[model samples]
Target: MATSAVPSDNLPTYKLVVVGDGGVGKSALTIQFFQKIFVPDYDPTIEDSYLKHTEIDGQWAILDVLDTAGQEEFSAMREQYMRTGDGFLIVFSVTDKASFEHVDRFHQLILRVKDRG
Candidate 1:
């Protein structure tokens, strides 16, 4: 009798956050990564979570992805989300100047919320 060689159940899990200004393709990018589908339209996101299994260099890992709303009004809850993520993907459309400007702010906020210098 041969036991299974894959230890999928033992793989580590990571919490990832995708953040950017509104309409900056944050959701589309996340969905594409998890489902292999590209969404052509834009819809505002409040908050969304996704799970996906990925393998890299013969190692398996599970990802818990969080998609965040880009609107400034949701800024109040940003700290809470920041605290939960192990990593973040900050996105901004090359054509959108306003969105580009806010990237630094988001990065700063994440550091502050996570209490990292």
Candidate 2:
């Protein structure tokens, strides 16, 4: 019997959540990372997920990334997703002062939701 180069089972999964103010490029960043393309359009994202299998530090793993809405209207959904995230990426547009300033709020919210102080 031939052995497969990459195992199909028992791969660890890392759940990453991206958050930031609207138009701060959260979706753009996520798309670029997963799809290797730049999306200049600014369509609001409620929530989007992408999955990939790759090697990490010589071990196979799965990357499950969640791109979340930056609009205040979707704030209620933040905590729900944050609770399951193993890591987070707080995005902000340097050109937008307000979005840059709101990074702390997003960080604090994540800390609060994850009970990580």
Who wins the lDDT comparison?
Answer: 2
- What's the TM-score of every candidate structure? 0.86, 0.91
For model 1, give the 10-residue run with minimal summed lDDT.
1-10
Model 2 gets an lDDT of: 0.91
lDDT tens string, model 2, 1-117? 443477788999999999999999999999999889999999999999999987777788999999999899998999998999999999999999999899999899888888952
Residue-level lDDT for 28 in candidate 2: 92
* Model 2, residue 80: C-alpha shift (Å): 0.5
Tens-place lDDT digits, model 1, residues 1-117: 433355668788889988889999999999898789999998899999998776645666888999999898998878888998999999999989988999998899889888852
TM-score attained by model 1: 0.86
Count of backbone clashes for each model? 0, 0
Which stretches in model 1 have alpha-carbon errors above 4 Å?
A: 1-8
